[model samples]
Target chain A: MDVLRPSPSGVVAAEITIAEPMVRLRGVSKVYRSLRRNGTDVEALRPLDLNIARGEFVTIVGPSGCGKSTLLSLIAGLSPYTTGEIDIGGRPVAGPYTDLGIVFQKDLLLSWRTILDNVLIQAEVRGLDRRKAAARAAELLALVGLSGFEQFLPHELSGGMRQRVAICRALLHNPPLLLMDEPFAALDAITRDQLTLDFQRFWQRDRRTVVFITHNLVEAVFLGDRVIVMTPRPGGIAEILDIDLARPRNLAVRDTPDFARYTRRIHDLFIETGIIKAE
Target chain B: MSTRTRNHADAGHPGAIEGKPAGGLDKGEAPPMRRTRRRGAGRGFRRFYSVIATIVVLLIWEGGVRLFAVPALILPAPSVVFATLWERRDLYIAFSVPTTIEIVIGFFVAAVAGILLGILVSFSSFARSTFYPMLISSQLIPKVAIAPVFVIWFGTGLESKVFIAFLIAFFPIMISTMVGLQAIETDMVKLFKSMGASSTTTFIKLRLPAALPNIFAGMKIGMTLAVVGAIVAEFVAADRGLGYYLLYANGQLDSPGVFGAIMLLTVIGVILYYLVEWSQHLFMPSALIRAADLTQATM
Candidate 1:
C-alpha cells in the first residue's frame, strides 16, 4: 500500500497516519426493477467490497453488461444502489455526491458554448470565483495542449480534442475524486493512446483518486495503480491486481514486460471467466 | 382551401434555405481547407441553380400566358402582376400595415405564451395531463374554421385577427418547446445533478439553451402560420389588409390586382419565416454546427 502523504494544503504529518480511504464500498449491489417487465428484476451488480485510498488511480475492466458503468455511477452517488454502504471521504453517500468529477463515454460538451465556456460550466454550476476558475480553466486547457482552441465551439474540434475539453471541464473544479466511464471509447486508436498518456500526466500533477472504467485491458494496466477485473452480468470483482509500475510512465512503458504481464493477467482472467472465447 | 395553403406554407419552405449552410458543414471530420472550398463552390452552384430555375419558371409562365392568349380576368402574367403592384404601391402598403401589425403582435403573444406553457407542461405532471390533451385537441380543430368565431367574439378589429394569429401560431411553438425540454440526454441531466446544480440552474443553463434550436424551428413554423391566421381572419371579415384587398379586387374582376395581393402575401410569409431563422442564428450560432453533426451521425 502506498503511504498516505500530507495534503499539499499543509495538514500535519501526524494526521496523515489516520487518513481514511477516499472511497469505501461495502456489499454494494444494484437490481433494476421494471414495471413494464411485469415486475421482473435485472441484477446489474452484485454485493462487493472495495477501498480506494486517497490519490490512488484505480481502473476497472470488464466485459459488456458487467456493470462497470453501474459501479461508477454507484460511487458517484448518481444512482441508487439496492444494497450496501458507500462512503466518500468518510461521509455516507445519500444522493448525488458534489465533491467529485465525472466523465462519460460521450464528451457532452454544450454545442453552443466555446471550449473555454464549456470548461467554465463547472465553475458556473459550482458557483466558484469566475476569475480564478477562468485562470484554472486556461491552465487545464494548456495542459491538454488545447490552449489555442479555447474560443472554438465543440464541433470545430476533432473527437479527441472535444474529449480533452471534457477532461478539462471535469478537472476545472479540482475535485478530489474523478470518475471516468470509457471517456476515450469514441476516439480513434492513435488519439486514444495520446489521451491515455495525457491523462496519466494529468493524474500525476495532482494525484487525485480516479476510478476509471474501461473495457480495454491494456488501458487498465497502463493507467491504473490497481486494475479491478469484473465478472459478466451481476458484476462482482474477480481480481484486483496492483500494477506496481513506476511514476511518469510513457507510451513506451506499455511495451515493457511488466505492462504486458499485467495486461496478460487481465486477458487470461477474461478467458477463464468465459468473457473471451479461445475458439 | 385556406387550410391547405397554410399546410403547404408550413411544410418545407424555410427549412430549404436554413438547411443549406448546415449541409455544407456535415462532413465535420473532413480537412478544413478542402471542406471549406468544396462547401463554397457547392453553395454558390446551388444559389446559381435556384435563381436560374426561378427565372426559367417565370419566363415559361409569361410565354405560356402570351401564347395561349389567356384572358386577363382568368390569369394575369407575372409582369402584369408586378405592374399592378408597382402602380398601386401606396394602397398595398396602407393595407399591408394592418396585416403586418396583426401578425407581429399575435406572433409575439404566441411565442411568449407558448414558451411559458411548454415549460409548465414539461415540468409539471399536472399541467401535462390537464393541458396537453386539450392543446392537442385544439390543434385538431381546423384553425380556419374558427376564424369566424374569433370575429364574432373579438369583433372585426385587429384583436380578432391578432387572436386568430395567436391561436394558429402557439401550437407549434408550445409543442416544439416541450419536445426540446424533454429531449435532453439523461446522462447530461445526471451530470448536472452530480454537480449539485439546482433545478432552476439546470433549466436555465442546460435545458433552455439546449432547447433553443428546437424552439427556433417552432418559431419559424409559427411565424408563417401567424401570417396565414391573420390573412384568414381578414378573409372572414375585414375592411383592410391583403386578404380583404384580394376579395375586393376579385369582386371588381381585377385579376391583376388579386394576383398582386397574393404576391404580396407570399413576400410577407417568406420574410417573416426568414426573420425567425435569422433570430435563431443570432441567439445560437452553433446551432448549424450541431445540426450538421446530427446529420453526420445519423448518416
Candidate 2:
C-alpha cells in the first residue's frame, strides 16, 4: 500500500527539481449529497493525494462505479470537492480552472457551428485574439487530418471525425493541462486505434500535462506516463504503475511484451479488487 | 407467386405493402437501392396524391349537392363558396385586415414576453417555483371563459383581442423555451464552465442556439393558436374583424357569406403558420435539415 501511494520522488528526479508539479491534489475527495430528503449520501471518491508533473500524461483506469471521472472533475474545478485542496500551476482552484483543455466522451460540438467555428469556440469564450486563435485552430485541425472539413457542420462528420474535431477544439487554446474522460471510448476498434496513434503524435508535438480517464486497460497502459488504477466506489488509487515504454509508440507497440506486461499488471489488480472475475 | 402463398407470407410482415414488387424485375434490384429510390419518388407521389385527393373530395361534394338536390342554406357547393368569396372580396378583405393585424401583433408580443419569461424561470429557482405552477394553472383555465373578462377589462377595442391572442399563444412558447434551455447536457455545461465562459456568454452562445429548435416548434404551435385566440376575442366582443363578420353573416342566414369569411380566416391562419416556419428555416437551416434527417432515419 505504501509503495502504491503516488509520490513526487517516483517521477524523474531531474524534472521534479526543475519546477513544481503542474497539478497537486492533497487528500482530495467528493461526496454527493442525495437529492431526496431521506436518501443516503454517496461517497463518490475517497480522499487521496497525487502530483502530476508538467508534460506528463497520466491515465486513470477503473470500473464503472469507480469515481475516476469525479477526480478529473475535481482537478478541472467543474464541480466542488467535498474535502482537501487541489492546486493547478500553483494556484488554488476555486471555480473552473480555465487554463486547461478538457474533452468528454461525447464531442459536445454545437450542431449549428461549422468545424472551424466549433474549434474557435474555446478562443471565443476565453476572449483570445480571434486571428491568432483561428490560425491555431486551422493548424490543430490540420494536425488531426481535419483540414478540409473546416466548413462542414458537426452532423456531416462521422463520429470519429467529430471526435477529432473536438480534440482540435480542446487544443486550440494551447492550454498547459489537458484532461480527457474516455475521449475514444465511443469509437469503433479501428477508429480508436487510429485515434490513439494520432493522439501520440499530437501529444509529442507539445507535451501538455494530461490526466486522462479510461476503462480500457490497454488504452491506459498505451497512453499514460503513469497509469493510475482505481478501486470501485469511493474510488482511491489502487496502484500507479510507471509506463516505461518509449514515446511516440505505434499500434505495434501494443502487441509488444512490455506493453502487454503493463496491461497484464493492471488487469491483475482489477481482478484482485474484484472489479473483474476470471471464473 | 400465387395470391394465397403471397398473402400467407405477408400476414405478419410489417413491410408487406412497401416490399411488394411493382413489377417482377423490381425484386432483382438491391433492396437498399430499391428502398432509396422508392423514398425519393414517394415524396413527390405523396404531394401529388394529396392534391388529387383534395380535388376528389371537392368534386364529390359539388356533385353530391347537385345530385341529391340539397338546399343551398344547408351546404353550399365549392363553386358557390368560391363565387361568393369573389363577389364579396372587398368586405372579406376589409374584415380580414383587422383579424390579420390582431394575429400578427399578438403573436409578436407573445414571442417576446414568453422568451423573456422562459429565460427568467430557467435561471432563477425562485421564479421557477413561483411562476411555473401558476403558468400551468393559467393554461388549465379555459382562455375562452376568461376572454370575456379581457373584453370587460380592455374593452371591445383591438387591445382586448390582441391580449387574448397573446394569452393563448404564450404558454407553449414559455414552456417549450424553458424545457429547451434546461435540456442541455451536464457535461456540455461543465465544458462551458471550464472555458471560463460567463453566465451571459453561456446563455447567449450555448443555451440560446441549442433552444432555437424547440423555441421554433413552440412558435409554430403558438402562431396557429394566436389566430384562434384573436377570432375568439372578436366573437366575445368586436365591431370589426373576420369573427364579427362571420357572426353577422350567420345572423343574416347568408351561408355563402359565412363560408367566405371562414375561407379568409383559413388563409390568414395558414399564412401566419408558414411565416413562422420560414423564420425558423432562415435562422436555423442546419437544425431544420438535421430534424429532417432524423425523421428520415426513423422512417
Clash-forming residue pairs, model 1: none
The TM-scores, one per candidate, come to 0.88, 0.88
- CAPRI accuracy category, model 1: acceptable
lDDT tens readout by residue for model 2, B140-198: 99999988899889999999999999999998999889989999999999999999999
**What docking class should model 2 receive?**
incorrect
Candidate 2, residues A1-279: lDDT per residue as tens digits?
012223333346236525778899999999999999999999999999999887778999999879998899999998899999999889999989998889999999987777788899899888999999999898888777766557656765677878988988888887889999999999888778878877987776666778899999999988888899999898999998988887667788989999989988998998999899887
lDDT value, residue B45 of candidate 2: 69
Off by over 4 Å in 1: A1-19, A36-38, B1-34, B37-56, B286-299
**lDDT digits (tens) for residues A28-106 of candidate 1:** 9999988695777999999999988777788999997999999999998889999999999889999999999989899
- DockQ of all candidates, in order? 0.31, 0.21
| lDDT (C-alpha, whole model) for all candidates | 0.83, 0.83
Say what the interface RMSD of candidate 2 is.
15.2
How well docked is model 2, in DockQ terms? 0.21
